[model samples]
Every structure is written in C-alpha cells, then in structure tokens.
Target: MPHTPGSYTTSDLSRKSGDIIAEALRHPVTITQRNKPRLVLLNIEDYDRLMRQSDARSAMTLETMPDELFGEFETAVGAYADSDEAGR
Candidate 1:
C-alpha cells in the first residue's frame, strides 16, 4: 500500500492503538512525546527492506567495481575538476 507516515502523539497512540498500529503496518509511523519525536513504528517487511537497503549502501566500494565503471568514474571526476563549480 502507498502511504506517507504521519506523526502520532503518545496520547494519540494510547487512544487509537489499533488504528495507529494498522497505519504503521502500511508505512512507518512517527511516535512523539512532548512534541519531540522519539520512535518509529514499521512492519517487519518494511523494516527488513530498510535493513537490506542500508546493508547494500554500507557494502558499496568503488574498488570492487568493474574496470569500465572505474574508468567512467575517473572521467566524471576529471570533468568535475574542469567544470566551473570545482571551487565552489
């Protein structure tokens, strides 16, 4: 389901636990107390998806990339140095 997580105060959570949890199962829900966000509620599948994405990002390494990609990366870097935004 497509959903954008919405904030829920502690009081709100306590008053609407079922609805809040059901919403959280569809998308992450922000839990707040005293106007400060304290926690996130997400379903297991979504949590696992986040973990997998994080793991993939953490495991990235340019050194392990193919030679063609490395060469293209180098070319892009050189182009950056040649561009007007290098100093900025």
Candidate 2:
C-alpha cells in the first residue's frame, strides 16, 4: 500500500522519529504539513535510480537532430531532394 503521510501527525513522528526513519528506509515516506504533501523521503538506491532514469530520458530527447548547423530542416531536405532529382 502507498504510504500515507497523513496517517501520522508531526507530533507522532517527533516523538518516535527513529521509527519514522526506519519506516522511510523500507519505503518512501510522503511527509505532509497542513494536509498537503511537502516532502518525500526515499532511500539512496531509489533516489539514484530515479535520477538515472531522468538523465536517460533527457539524453533520448537530444538524439534526433537536423543536419543543418544554421538553417531550417525543410530547407535541408528540399536541397537534398533537388540535388537527387538533378543527378537523375
């Protein structure tokens, strides 16, 4: 089940903070204040995994690119097509 931060008040955590940290170690703890989620405490492994996935997604978005260094891609494609037709 997803951890519910609202289930425990700040006082509950402050009084038994070690238990809270231990629980967070097992899974992320969604910490809330004033009934809104304010923080997520995750173990190191999970945080690292999330960061790696974000980096991979950013890399994938940069892979496909136009050939021209200074002009629109349509101009590049049209130039290529015109050259091919002339050669034929």
Candidate 3:
C-alpha cells in the first residue's frame, strides 16, 4: 500500500474503503489506526518507478570503475595539456 500525505483513520477507511482504494491508485493513501499511521497503498506503476529509482540511486561503480573505462578521459586531458604547452 502507498502512503499519501495525510492520515486516514481505520474507521474512515472502513466507511469509504472503495474511495480510499481509488485514491490510492492515483497516489498514496496513509492508513492510521489508533491515531498512528500504519500503512500506505500505492499504485503499481508508482511503486515500480519508485523501486527503479531507488535501485538506480543505490547502484554505483564510477569511482571504483576499472581504469580502462575512463582511460580515454585521462588521455584526452593529457593531449590537451601537451597541446597548450606547445602553443605557449
């Protein structure tokens, strides 16, 4: 379930569960029990997108990337410095 920006009591949900579900499909619905938020309902698409974004953010390797992957950048910089010195 996705969590919306506001709180909805369990009783409120019991009374309007269908509407709550529809709203959840569009965004997220926070479910509260005992005045405390307990769950969230999110649309599948939103959930998938969030998961993918989180995975992308957590995935990393550029800093630890093998030198071969960025050797061209160093080579290009070296060439530029050499050319600048020759021009001077």
Candidate 4:
C-alpha cells in the first residue's frame, strides 16, 4: 500500500514512541499492523472535540435540544419525508 502521511507501523510505534507521540500532538497519527490501519493516536483536545461531535449526533430528547438545533432537525426530517414520499 502507498505510504500515508502520519502513518507508522506497529514496530515503528514501539521503537519511536516519543517521536510518534510528538507528531500526534500536532495531528492525528495512524498506527498500522500487517499493513492494515489499526489505531489512531491523537491529542486530548482533538479526542474531546470528536467525542463532543459524536454526542451532538447521538439521540436526544426534544426538551434537551437547543431551539436552533431543534428547528434544523425539524426541517431536515420534513425534507427527508418529502423526498421519501416522492421516491415512493
């Protein structure tokens, strides 16, 4: 496979952990094994940001959602239902 930026093999990770972690602090790094991608190393800020984004996408009660987001959700659901009915 073609070499990807920020990608390191498992052996490279074991041998060059400090260097790899430094690089990960600047951006995400992929850890590969057997030429397949296995894991990602990222800074805590990036990880937390990803988790927050995931939380935003997860199921929530209408009462818990902000008014703007609820409006957008309502609009999206209506558009999706309209499209689905058109397809049928």
The candidate that wins on TM-score is 4
Q: How many angstroms is residue 29 displaced in model 3 relative to the true structure, after the best TM-score fit? A: 1.0
Clashing pairs in 2: none
Instruction: Kindly give the stretch of ten consecutive residues in candidate 2 with the minimal lDDT sum.
Output: 55-64
In terms of lDDT, which candidate is strongest? Answer: 4
Could you tell me the TM-score of candidate 3?
0.52
Model 1 alpha-carbon miss at residue 65, Å: 22
CA lDDT for candidate 4: 0.93
Write down the RMSD of all candidates, one decimal each. 8.3, 7.4, 6.2, 6.8
- Expressed as tens digits, the lDDT of each residue in 1-88 for candidate 3 is 4434655778878888888888898888888887677888889999988988784434436687568856876788899999999999
Off by over 4 Å in 4: 55-88
* TM-score against native, each model: 0.54, 0.53, 0.52, 0.60
- Give the candidates in order of TM-score, highest first: 4, 1, 2, 3
Q: Residue-pair clashes per candidate, as listed?
A: 0, 0, 6, 0
Q: Is candidate 2 or candidate 3 better by lDDT?
A: 3
C-alpha lDDT (0 to 100) for residue 76 of candidate 1:
95
Write down the lDDT of every candidate, Cα atoms only.
Answer: 0.82, 0.68, 0.79, 0.93
> What are the per-residue Cα lDDT tens digits for candidate 1 across 42-63?
9999998888878443344797
Error of 1 at 78 (Å): 24
**Cα lDDT for residue 29, model 3?**
83
